[model samples]
Target: MTPLTGGVASDIASLKVGDARYCVKFALPKLKVAADWRAPRHRNAAEYAWLEVAARVVPESAVRLYGRSDSAHGFVMEFVTGAETYLWKTALLEGQPAKGEARAVGDMVGRIHAASAKPNFDRSFFWNRDDFRALRIEPYLSFTAEQHRHLAPQLHDLADMLYDSTQVLVHGDVSPKNILIRHGRPIILDAECATMGDASFDPSFCLNHLILKAVHLPAQRTALYDEVAQFWRAYAPHVSWEDASDLEARICRLLPALMLARVDGKSPVEYLGTPRREQVRKLALPLIGNPPATLSDFVQTLTSRLKELDAWQR
Candidate 1:
């Protein structure tokens, strides 16, 4: 039999076993994607536990958890397969898949978030000194003096506020990259750093993460944000603009720090050259400051600037 080729992210290894193909996912602390810690480690057992619950709740949208083994950081599990979601969307945007498939991706997240609203388990993390220590303080100490001084203060305030927010299971991370367009719908994967905290945490991550990559390409950012935001808006209708307002406030405040967290956060992604990554990192320089007077003011200013720069990118 021929080796089974993958149709998703290359973070995993796969093989064809006789008449069957096994999809395996690998995760290590050293891979250094942002937000996880080194100590007790991300409830590897707990993550698996939550995976079980997530499977039960969002079966259609959740990846099947088969088995696991420990790695330098966490553990590996069976790979979720169908079609690589990020590639699917990108291909669709480039005019490959059907347009409806793109729209369905948005709705899929909304539904997932809805189910996550009442998580079967406890997964919230307090944005306290511990989280900061594991994520920012530790990773950042590796940077030069200027970068540390620049990032530390902002992370402090953002962590402080994040510590005081309401909890929810918002997929923790929801970039287009992590999504798989299996069977023509969105199936979210990578729940390792999945946390239960701050209702805005996940969606805010979705909004800022993959979408921010498009920031340097404002038209792309706007187009993507429109699709993404519409998905969230329609999916979580009960989630009022006021609710969004509050979360958006927190997201804006944390934007600069979050950018730094990418490079310094525990599970940081490799800084492969992408126009989005390079420019956003550069533009983030002046934004992650000490505490701003009010969240609203901070949000308004940052968003206006985000819009202006993104538009200029076009």
Candidate 2:
């Protein structure tokens, strides 16, 4: 058995069964990290159920499930390997630019959310928000608020706004680490945080990674911004909201809050230095206090603010 790294939510190991290989995933009641974070064991069941639903919607982007073990609270799925396939985050970290690739991933996510939004789509199993709170809110948002006492009220309000919405399906953790690129498209993994909630969460969550990577690798800032723009361009057309402007506004508002969370939250990015972390805090505080009017506006404001702060030099 080979243990996989880069994930803290589950116990994942690779195994070879006969001539084929599979990935076994087990959801623990608490994060393996040194924290009080805990969630129900059945969240693994929710992930398995989501995979089954996602496969039917976008088989190309879904990882195939092999089986499950109730006693272990785990499941087995196809192991994506070979020279042609690699983790998207690994590729990005190695300086491989993702221009068109980001748009394809956005299109795929948009299609999944769009198809699942159909009137007859059954979303009964994903209605639970306990896992979302334990895994996302408490650790990422609420915990971050605790670190910055002054921002507690706004952060709490934002957390409430997230939980109050249940309009579209949300993939709570859309980080690059969970995406594997095979051929020309992205195959999404780790659906334990999947739920029926605001569709904006998925895109905003993904965008947060792009922004953070730009922060980590200052030289790639322009390329990363282009990718974010490309992703929004490809995905926005598929959103079927009555008030597109309002939803975009919400996305803009959430982006800074999430960006701040990555630096101050329970799971801060490992690559960031002390100076970079401070840069993130400085950039986020103002944006959270005054949200931008549009995604483009947010991007522009972020770029200008970072420039004014000399974030790249730091």
Candidate 3:
């Protein structure tokens, strides 16, 4: 096996699984998209499920999972070689409008989420909360004593309100990196966090990454916001401003918590790890008090406020 790429969570390798060698992505337990906050997915099972669903719904994008044999902690997947979807999306974020690809990704995710349940694919594998730990509480609950003062009271109230507010089958970690834009379209990877319920979770996960990426490159914050809106527009066109208003409101409140949890929790991104981690927690701490009114309001306010934050940082 040849080393392709490596990170804190998972390491990508290329190996032969018979005559055709597929890309083997050995994912660590921490990177497996945990059950409680992130919700976990058995990679082998996810690969099999998505493969079956993709065969019917969005056939072009799904990969075939040979099987999984657990090693010390992490497991791997066999896949065909492809260009980096993260690089492709980053190019788009840099102004290359892969509009057709974006729409295709939207259509794919929508179809998969909306796909009819088939016999081979059991939705229960993903939806069950065996290790269901609220990831939202991580940043707040695990805060250092100094950080605790700034967060404790606010987190308490937020947790109280959000404890049982809503839950759903979420692709808890969808981002540019998890996607593969082969040529002009996106094929999704890593299905461990697919859960059932609030549709908001998946889209919110996508949106948060765009915002987080924008934070580092301050000048392109607005562009990132546009990209986020475009993706969301693709995912949920059926729900208009009136229909999805409540979901959006809830999503906005949940997002800061999500972002904070992501950074301060276990799999924090080293790129924005330490400093912005604290910044995100502090930023999200406020939403525990006043959530937005609708998705449109949430997206509008969320993106707009994020721009202001970038401007302030500059």
Q: Pick the candidate with the highest TM-score.
A: 2
lDDT (10s digit) by residue, model 1, range 1-314: 22233321123556566666665544434433333334334434445555665577667766666676554334444555543444443542343424444355556545545555554534444223343334333553333223566565555655555545445554444655666676666666655544445555555455555444445344454455455445555545545323655555565555556665564444344432465555556555666654243433544554676767657778
TM-score of each: 0.65, 0.96, 0.72
Q: Model 1 off-target regions past 4 Å?
A: 1-11, 26-29, 32-42, 69-79, 82-151, 163-166, 216-221, 238-242, 263-278, 281-314
Ranking by TM-score: 2, 3, 1
Q: Report the lDDT tens digits of candidate 3 across residue range 153-263.
A: 655544455433324334544666677676656767755434443555566666677666666555666676666667656766644323455656656766665566556
Between candidates 2 and 3, the lDDT winner: 2
Worst 10 residues of 1 by lDDT: 1-10
Report the CA-based lDDT of candidate 1 relative to the real structure.
Answer: 0.50
Residues forming the 10-long window of minimal summed lDDT in candidate 2 = 305-314
**By how many angstroms RMSD does model 1 differ from the true structure?**
6.0
TM-score result, candidate 2:
0.96
User: Which order, best to worst by lDDT?
Assistant: 2, 3, 1
Question: How displaced is residue 120 in candidate 3, in Å?
Answer: 12
Question: Considering TM-score, which of the candidate structures 1 and 3 is the better prediction for this target?
Answer: 3
Candidate 3's C-alpha runs over 4 A off are 7-11, 17-19, 26-44, 68-78, 82-102, 116-121, 132-169, 238-243, 273-282, 299-314
Output candidate 2 Cα RMSD: 1.5
